[model samples]
Target: MSDLRDAALVSKAWPFEEARRVLKRYQKQPPEKGYVLFQTGYGPSGLPHIGTFGEVARTTMVRRAFELMSDIPTKLICFSDDMDGFRKVPTNVPMQEELAQDLNLPLTKVRDPFGTHAGFAQHNNARLCEFLDSFGFEYEFASSTEYYTSGKFDEMLLKACWEYQKIMDIMLPTLGAERRATYSPFLPISPKTGHVLQVPMLEVNAANGTVVYQEPDGEKVEIPVTGGNVKMQWKPDWAMRWAALDVDYEMSGKDLIDSVTQGGKICRALGKRPPESLTYELFNDELGQKISKSKGNGLSMEEWLTYAAPESLQYFMYLKPKTAKRLYFDVIPKAVDEYHQQLRAYPGQDLKAKLNNPVYHLHGSDMPASDMVVPFSMLLNLASASSAEAKETMWGFINKYAPDATPESHPNLDAAAGFAVRYFNDFVKPNKVFRAPTDQEHAALADLALALSSEEAALAAIAKKNAAMGNEDDLPVADFADDDFLQSVVFAIGKNHGFEPLRDWFKAIYEVLLGASQGPRFGGFIALYGVKETVALIQAGLNNELTK
Candidate 1:
């Protein structure tokens, strides 16, 4: 839907200016130690959505830049409010009385009826942390559960609630929402009577005394007046977070635009410095709703690592400002396409380079990288192998065609490739989605079946004779540009040989041979074994004993 030039990383409307010379007032600090980055992610009712990590990942680039910007340590802190009561049920996980009772609250206090979390909020917090680290996010993580239980943030929370009245006045009107009568700046559940109530706002009483919220139901509340008492509401909390952690920048989704509005007001109320806020529209599914784990509509970042490279995904994130409009989820397909296309744009050069340079941000995320359809020959050869062989084999080919798949071609790919391979295995798996033959290609399958049944072995010998191909790693790199013979046989064999292409081929080969398509590349992959072993792979698939 966009005819925007690739030069702008898909910014059709406005050109991005990554060249801001002067740091804002709040961002100023000693050159040796750069901005301290802190971001919020994880109630962890289930796994974090792509949107959640999107914020962290975007912030990471800034941190890395700051890492280069500073001589001293640049830090990122990922805070998880695991102590919050579970607000709602996550799909696929069972909901029960405990969940209903704890609804509209943080997840740390909820009971996992599915029996996975095992009667604790801490388990889900761990899951969220695991998920974040899995996405290659570098963060110093903290949990609200630990923070509160250990009294690490008691002063802050107490102060915030103490100034609850003033904070509420500024925050509510800013968001245009009225506070509920029963709502308190803080929520308290009576473990004894199962009564949930909010304390009434405390009056300062014009005296030197600690004031706290009083409930209409008759419980008198008070607080100790002396300490480093400072409080802020949600709106002001944003600014306070910046001042507290010395945040340089933060990117939030549009859903938080109102919160930021409210937050900005709080900053003014508290007379504290606020962090600069950048807003990206939330990534949504085809149904056009925000991707949320609670709604079961969001896919995890780890789920995305499969089927596409992480750099490609990262490239996808950077192509446009996170604050842009129309941030489509389907953009990933475009992202993938551009990655492949860029690889093909300069065949024989290290393809991983395509993922490295800032130029990698040229397209959207969902697109496949190349237009050079994976020669059916390569896919067929791969499908007729075992998972280990297929994994080894395919990675070899990808590393050859697209250098970004392995770190040997480019060191940055080292961590990224390992993630890509494992993500595919765990999330997508060898059998996740089948590469079905096209309807227009009906004759192809029948002809392929014939080729396999007859004249196949002798032809296989001919294919072997015509080929010295190993894993892409071992395949002799050459300018085979005009080599029609090599191309012909490769595609032809694919037409008559394997049922799966690159992805499924690896998956099926792994399934039939090693029981998974997730090892090394195929060119060198087949070499680790040999033709006889490769032939056995094809036979195994025909026999349908998958687990074997």
Candidate 2:
């Protein structure tokens, strides 16, 4: 193994470790190709979802890690299996009845239901490209229809024809008795109807590179496998792709673990070694059901990007990919907040720590030097509570809290504020319920409001005291701005009024102010919302004057 690969194995970073494992396997017996190749596959059955983005993004991250660890050149192929037959109409697409008419036909041959592209596959493929391009992903896209029809897969198709019997033996044992009795690795496209035929093969002529199958109309026909006459069944196709492209690494959802195993066997049977594979856990919905594009059961990429930055989604995928996580709209705020926190810490980190940071990897070599001026969660709150329509309105509040900041200087904050406004209008505003505070909670908030109203006076006094002590430049703003100070102040008031353990007091404050049990740090919230406005908000909550 190279020094870089060795170092990667010990780094303990998951992406690096994954790359190290793949490289180690290659080192044991190198590939036919000189450089590494990473592949991520998409079935153009529906629009790209969060899972699609996750697969491509995670694969890209692994590819990046491999590039960093070794001098070997690398390529990532975003392959679309557009040649696959349309088994059923997608629920999310239009003209479902029209799409159903083309059942069992290659997706690329089906009419574009949305009227936006040449075919069904083309429409989805175009969408996938647009989505990936928006995030500036670097990859080469290959369409299976083009590959097969243009003779790029001729040699592999002929080889599969020659090894048909052997491939059948390898696959049949894994199938049910009925399937085992009739299964063929190749499915011929009927010359008459243009539908892919799944009929039983009568004979295979290895030398002629053809298979004879009885069509639905009861006619036995022989067809070449080489000239897009036939397509490999998915398992065999996956194996053939691995061998044909000499894929070094690839990943799939955990549901494909069995297929990966079967593909490995089929590849070895074809005199080619299977690629190194990782089966990551699939994303689940809030109900704990596995998220599926076909089922339309989880959050969409559009929904995520609509509310948060692309980097936030990338960072969410970067973390613990091997474990299943809920991909829902509710998770967006935390992901956005986490991205900001990482960006903030990135500059202070050492080289090793920087490399380990998710933000550093998300940006590749062009890591940003600073964090956003305000947390996205806070921005969402500010935008929703104030009904801010434009970035200027949010910026007005932000500037009031952090006078040193500017929209031009903090472009990320500006952009985030804009997204938060749109997101709040669409998702948060209609759903939010502002509850009136309890009498005890109301009393507590009233006291906190009184304290906030006096904050300016306290700050002025501190400044005067500092000036007298010959430390005019070192105002005690940090002391007051700290969460500890806010916690201490809330705790002291709550303790005097018989509310125990400061946490309940803080939770009550959050519930009254933000309509949640938790929120952005109170000190930061107060600063961003403006001390006077926060005091008034608290006073409104106490008086039960806020709207529910």
Candidate 3:
């Protein structure tokens, strides 16, 4: 196993080497005692997808690197730019889909289906925050709405309008020709009309203190916008954010090639060096195009968490360089399985002696082993079928089976509780989505149920079965890994309860009741779902099978 920090270095190409170096660069040293702030920003257009985290998580990596590079602690900040008037609605926005018919009006005036978040900005911004929290990151989150009203970027805003535009003219041609045309040399807003001056975008001269509004197919009119100024347009916003936030590093996707290139101009204009940036790849769902929410296709980070472990995500983040393109969810399950293998193999390997090599970071930190946990889909099935399963209830079960299970204090237990509630409410899929069971699967499950008649019996059965499964030996799967643990879990539930050892019986319990067999311990999960429904699922499924 290579060091985790050295994970992405496969090529000798300049860009690849530079990225690897940037990834390994020192920010922790003394002359720069200031905390390394790795920043992530998103335009509050709509619900942010996994790609959003793709950037933030990379920022986390840089922060993690800084922590490792020296004694200096690094901080990660995710900025949500909610103040920017909606650019053409994101392809993910549902309401904006219809509103594009209105020619990309201000999102404020448009009706958004997703409530709780105010306007397009608020709606999407809320989703991003919720997603970020899911990753268990510790960071200060700031919204542009707050920053704008709070006047944090006031100076940068002023500079963008005053100085950013001048830099854009110089930088735009370098990015491409179309950019030079679409971008206004300066932000044109009317203090009087309080509307963006679009047609004659250049009419209002904040310099001349003049407001010019031109109606479509109408003569140029003048309107005044006094208080409505944020100054610089798009690139300026990027520049000002970099300087104001003191961001030493930020990660943007390849999609922002132009904006990032232009952002450099704005930074130079602000008389500051642009923060270090890495242009990572964009992700498309299984269909292989960019993930789009409005298209009803994007697998949100919420969805990813439902199916994959956080460490799986962390590993997948660097499985390829940020410059490469196209990642799919289908790849995660296997990677997660392999990640478990590496985690188990890392501790005993020569990696410990290789610490001086600087690649020790690629392998994860030392930890006790666990079993290969099942996919999120399976868990959803198990959880959905059995309603009583408390998350900690399952956690408690794992403690009984696995040796290293130390319970968190009561406060952290609250997190598991919340996770259970949401897990059952939103994420669990219906029985219809299940890939039909195979004869071998059915037989193995029944055999597993029989083995579960008692803990010792179940363990023995798993040990026997381990001879056949890939790398399923005594080695623990991962942090949450526990294949044998799960086997005992389901068996225990069936033998103790009336759930029985039959295929139809367990299937019903798993389908309508538990979202997966390979999930939280059946006993604890059953307690959360309750005895009646758990029993009912077993009884009803058998009845349904008999009738069919």
Candidate 4:
């Protein structure tokens, strides 16, 4: 374990360094239990979203890192705050009318408007389990309602009741003047209406562990804090949960930094220390605003998996956990490409380097030994350029490139090809509007077509020229070697025609041929799609047939 710590201290990976810090903290003040606990929270007021997945995935990664570095047993708890009241109905949910009527009631008490579960909270919790199960996350799910009703949290609730004044002292300073006078650490369940009441506590009897509060109908009622008669406010509840579960680590979004700070204070008041906490920046939508479930502005978990692999989404979460990232459709292809690149490079790296790789962490002990047949971005380009609508059409070209490749042997590539077809249709096809080439651009395209028609001759001509210039070794070893042959052929044609700003030449080729301003490398596309088909496509663009 000391060797593990020493090795982790020198590693460049953030997860390793984070694990080192956590282990050190525990050493200083050890947890009450033998095993280390990692917790992630989800509020069951709404359906599971992408942010929910991000938190669990990241926490699991850190937990895995800690498991590798120490002999300590580790447990991950996916805690659901299902006992919370439904302040308002989310726009994305069904049965808005019924939900609106249940405001101020605990989510577990509200009816399952979807008619799929026992209650609203149960529905969301089940959905969350379904979502996490899709990714095969190993976690223990704990419901706040069950914890409260089963008396698992009775000791913490009683402690909060006995120390109510101290908890109030810790929380009041952080609230506004108007809320300070009315605030209470315990919110009692209304016996009349079955809703969680936030009204002021009229009286407190710490000796009896009971508090009296007024309901909406002006009825004063007394209730015990134990046996699920009351629940603490958010900050105090967060602190109590940490102390009750002996949580070693937990993480939340940056917006909750103040809450964490306040909760730490409350934890101290309750005679317990708060858990180690991390604050990660929130995800932003394409519009540069925070992703809101009510607004429905960002990609959902199902939407992302619809167009990309699950590993790609996990990889996205694995990168820069503390940095804010855009979770939109446009970021999907790049994430897929990066995942593929890392997987391809994983087998060649040393042990430490391999462990540091995102794919290695994302896949854990089940990391694949081989790379995908091709890059996902290239597959997208191939699908778009070839006008293919089915995975079979794309697989034809992939099989041509690697004859031995089969779906059974290369599942990632097979999955990527299917996703590429879907992605091209949803995101790429509608935006494709080819432009007619000008006369000068047409001449450039003609030269490019001629070069493609006799690629071997073109490469030989460049090799002869290079050999004459005392740079014989500079000749390309293969047609696609470093794209040397393609670059030489294109540059020779451009220099002969005196074309200005060679970028416009490539732009013309892209816009006319692919109906986009940018795309995969032209040389690779030609090599993969074949010279004859590319020549014909370029000729169609030159003749103004592409715009049709």
Which candidate leads in lDDT? 4
Between prediction 2 and prediction 3, the one with superior TM-score is 2
True-vs-predicted CA distance for residue 267, candidate 3, Å: 1.7
Residue 29, candidate 2: C-alpha displacement in angstroms: 7.6
lDDT of 2 by residue, 1-548 (tens): 36444555567777877888777866665555877899999998877788998999999888888878777788899999999988988788778788889899999999997898889899889999999999888999999999899998888888887777778888888999998777889989899999887777899998998989998888889999887888999999999988788788989998899899989988887888788888899899989998866778789998888888888899999989888898898899889888889888887876667668887668865877554778889898888657788878998889876788887788788889888888888877777667877778877677676665675544544454455447646434434455455544555556645666767877777677776666666777766777677777887777776654
Q: RMSD for each model, in Å, please?
A: 10.5, 4.5, 9.7, 2.5
**Each candidate: how many clashes?**
61, 0, 51, 0
lDDT of 4 by residue, 1-548 (tens): 56545555566787776677678766765556878999999988877789989999988888888887777888999999988877888888888897899998898988998998889999989988998998999899999989988899898888887888888888899899999978987878777887887878888887888888887777778888887778778888889998788788898999999989988888887788677777899999998899875566788999999998898999999999888898899899999888888987888887777777898778865777554767788888899888999999998888766778989889888988999999999999999979998888888778777776675766665665565557756555446423445667766555445566877777777788888898776766666666677789888988888798
Clashing pairs in 4: none
Per-residue accuracy of model 1 over 1-548 as CA lDDT, tens digit each: 12222322322221122211113332556533354554654546665666666667666655443333334455677776564545456664565555677664445556666576554456655666776665657688876555545655554455554455667676455442344443344444333333323444455532443555544566655544223222223345355454445554566777788777776665555544455566777666666667777776655566566545565566566655554433343354456555555555643434333323333333323333343334322333333342322345555544444444444544433333344344444433445332323332334333333333434433553354345443223222222222332233234444344435634434443444444445334434343234345445445445544433
Query: Residue-wise lDDT of candidate 3 within 1-548, one digit each (tens)?
Result: 24433443443322334344544444344325366667788765566766777777666655554554345466777887655554565565556556565333333434566655446566666667776786677788887656765667665555554563476566666655665565553444434444444442545455654445454546565533323343345666677778777666777777788888777766777787677777777777676788654454656666656655566666666555555545554565555555566565555665333332222233325453534333233334343553435665545433433345344433222333334435555534332333333444444445544444444655655455455444364732312133445534465334433443444445644543233443444545444343344445544443344123
The 10-residue segment with the lowest total lDDT in model 4: 475-484
* C-alpha TM-score for every candidate: 0.58, 0.92, 0.59, 0.94
Candidate 3 segments whose C-alpha is farther than 4 A from its true place: 1-33, 87-111, 161-165, 171-182, 189-228, 293-296, 323-329, 350-369, 373-548
| Better-scoring candidate (lDDT), 2 or 3 | 2
- How do all the candidates rank in terms of TM-score, highest first? 4, 2, 3, 1
Report lDDT per candidate.
0.48, 0.81, 0.53, 0.82
- Point out where model 1 deviates above 4 Å: 1-22, 26-35, 70-72, 95-98, 104-106, 113-120, 149-165, 175-184, 188-199, 202-218, 223-239, 321-337, 340-356, 359-548
Give stretches of model 4 more than 4 Å off: 1-6, 28-30, 460-501
What TM-score does structure 2 among the candidates reach? 0.92
